[model samples]
Target: ITAKGKPQISTMRVIYQPQQGVTIVQWQFEQSIGWLPWEKLGSIMNDKILGPMMEKNLDQLRRLIEAETSSL
Candidate 1:
């Protein structure tokens, strides 16, 4: 899913996920999303500097996870 872009930089990735037979989600959680280092979803969700944002983020993630696991 990664690719090269400029002479020295890489092209950003734009991820997509399908739901109900349609594309319903798109996100890029990489630290490359900002000025920080590269980080995927899991580590970012548990990061301390972003602890405040995590409360809300994790809650949403929990809801999504529950919806996936329990159809709730």
Candidate 2:
């Protein structure tokens, strides 16, 4: 909630890059809208399929968001 008592949604994106062999992750949030709402979300990615790296990144993201929100 904000000072005006409205709710907000936090968004996250997980990206997987192959060939070069690495992954990238990003996070963002929505705040103070007059009406429209956005969904708070999570996602996963992998080089070939939903494999180890994907799972690992997803787990890390979950932990990160959990820890961040828990403090609020």
Per TM-score, the best of the predicted structures is: 2
Q: Give the Cα lDDT of each candidate.
A: 0.46, 0.57
Residue-wise lDDT of candidate 1 within 1-72, one digit each (tens)?
A: 334231222233334455543332332233333344543453466455555664576569657866897964
Name the regions of candidate 2 deviating beyond 4 angstroms. 1-5, 33-72
Looking at model 2, report the run of 10 residues with the lowest lDDT sum. 38-47
List candidate 1 segments past 4 Å from native: 1-49
For candidate 2, the TM-score is 0.35
RMSD to the true structure for each prediction, in A, is 10.8, 15.7
Query: In each prediction, how many residue pairs overlap at the backbone (N, C-alpha, C within less than 3 A)?
Result: 0, 0
Candidate with top lDDT is: 2
lDDT of 2: 0.57
Model 2 lDDT, residue 20, Cα: 70
